[model samples]
Target: MSYVLCLHRWVGRQALYERYGLEPGMQIRAICTAESAQSLPEDRLASISTLESLDDATAVIAEAQRLIELHGVPHRVVALNEGDLLNAAAIRERWGVPGDPCAWIERFRDKLTMLEVAARQAAIAILPAVSAEDPQAVQRLLAEHGYPLVLKPRCGTASRGVRILRQAQDLRLLQAPHAEPMMVQAFCAAPILHVDGWWDGERIVVLTASRYVNSCADFGPDSALGSIELDADEHERAIAEQVAALLAVFAGQREIVFHLELFDDGQTLRFLEIGARVGGAEIPFLWREVRDIDLVGIAWELQTEACSRQRDHARTRSRDGRPLHGERGAWVIGRRESPLRTELGTLYWAQEALPAGVPSGVYEGARTRLRLRSFDRPALVRDVERIFEHLAQTWSASA
Candidate 1:
């Protein structure tokens, strides 16, 4: 039998075990944080090991060694959490497992490195970015990119510690300083669109583009934000091609799940950043519910190489054999103060809520979240505008 070791600090454990548990000739062993141990399925308890913290690579390696002693060496080691990707890469390197190396993964984790790779290798346009610690470098970036800059943690997640320097006064926040490394980028006033899908070593197997109704900078604790799936139009197709090229430059030969964010500046698309794992927020849910595909499950399959299924499984067609990528599908996330009540009414609360995975709770400290989906393009657009209008009204009222 082949042994597979799965590591997860906060997310994707249940789904990982549920999918890998029943596969023939595979014995799945999961190592997760102590707090998440209880949440692991009771039936799958025997194969799970709880640790104080997965952030410690030593503890994880020790656990992996124990698993190796009991069973044979694991053929594959996996982690679903974005933060754990590096730790997982370290373990894979130690175990001589088949996966992307640490250096390759770092290109995606580090903001500065990602920009360099995108600009140099992929020939993609990126905003001027620099380390926030150096005073001279900061000034250079300001001089080149001008004001209205964006500052974020070099390795931040979920929009935490992200700030917008709209005016000269905002630069004061940078003066006080912090120990953690940060990056400053030129702020673009373009609508943000995210592309989520799988990238085989050679091609983009499946891809979907979503336009964010509200920019991340505008999102707040109670902000109403959503993304609508777009038809695979010419613009979307070009974006996908660009993303595939960038991934080819980053991963080389590794197959991985990719969530890429870009700025659609009317005339052209500019690079934002990319995540090697599945997209956060309602992206995975949208893939499963709206498109009838288990994106996370497919990612797991790619990691373990346990399944021989082709990417064709995720391809879609209408009753008349027309490609369905042009069809309408969307997901909207709203808070209690959102227009879902005033506009969507009962239809808003009718939809089911997805489990808050890993970095639980909403990004930007949202208190409550309501998610809804629709296949009607016009209806999706109308409802999205209503949500955005409600957000604008709420912001103005607070101001």
Candidate 2:
């Protein structure tokens, strides 16, 4: 029997277990923090070993060793959470298991290392970035890139601790003590587009290109964040090529899931940082709903190289078991912000009042999915604006 050790903080459990549980002779054991343990489904709870906290590496390692004693050395150690990526890799190396080692995973976790590697690749342009601690280096970047710089953690997720510095006074944020290293970069004005897919050791499988309605940097409790899957076009094709080239630069690392974000100004594509796991938020669901692609399932397959051909075949099949071109899908998050509350509440009410097929509900929670089709790009953009207008009106009326 093959054993897989799954480490997580708060995400990817359902998808990971559902895929791995299907494999014959595969035993899945999980080590998760107390908070995540409460959220586990009944079936998942059966095989899980809880930890007081995920912060202590020593505690995590001890729990992993206990699982190994009970189930034998894990054939593979998997961590879908970005924060736990290094820990998972460390465990794999300690056990001499067949998976990415700490050094290999660090290239993806550390922003500086990731950009340094990408900078050497052809056809890739990276924004000038430097450690915030080096005042002279930051001033050099400020002089070169000009005002309106970005400050963020060297290794952060979900746009946490991200700040925009528009002037000299904002530079004070850099002087503040940070728990982890932080970086400063030239702020790009172009819209952010994320390419969600996988690399099969050679080629990038183009799943979908999503255009963010609002900057991730702007995402907050009061922000209404969303994305729409872009139609297959020249722009998407170009984005896919760039993603392929970026992955090729890191050719040493193969068979992994990548969530690559880039800045596209009609004429140029600038490389933004990427995450080595599945894209956060509603991306995985968007892919599944619109393209019938199971990103998490594919991620597991990539690690084990199990059922690659089968998954490839399945990708071509639609939800109804027929070939599909694509479908327009939108995933929106309603935050505590008045605009989102009003817009999303109105939309939810409308969906409930209307018939089943009109904006069918896919998933609901902190993030919600609605099925509505816009015939063309202009129409889609207009529709999104209309929702914002409704939000504004609702906010005004309430005020």
TM-score of each: 0.82, 0.83
How many angstroms is residue 279 displaced in model 1 relative to the true structure, after the best TM-score fit?
Answer: 0.3
Put down candidate 2 lDDT per residue, 1-399, tens digits, no spaces.
666787766632336455443355665677886556644555633388887667667899999888888778877787776767888888888889887888888778788888898898767588989998899999999989898999999887677788999989999999888878999998999988887776666876555677888877776444556677687777777767767888887754577678888888877888888877888766765556546677777776666544675367545653322225555656555432333343332132122222222221112223323333443555556666666565556546766
lDDT (10s digit) by residue, model 1, range 1-399: 676787865532225356442356566678986656645555543488888777667888888889888877778887766767888788789778997678877877888888888876544577888887776888888888788899898877666688989887888877766656888889888998988877767777777878888765566655656778776567666776677777788666777778888898767778888889887666776666566666677677777777734244664422121225454455555444433347562133323343343334343124334445655666778866776676667767776
Which residue pairs in model 1 clash with each other?
Answer: none
lDDT of each: 0.69, 0.68
**Which parts of model 1 have CA positions greater than 4 angstroms off?**
9-16, 20-23, 34-45, 51-73, 121-123, 167-179, 310-312, 315-326, 334-367, 388-399
Count residue pairs with overlapping backbones in model 1.
0
Scored by Cα lDDT, where does model 2 land?
A: 0.68
Best by lDDT: 1
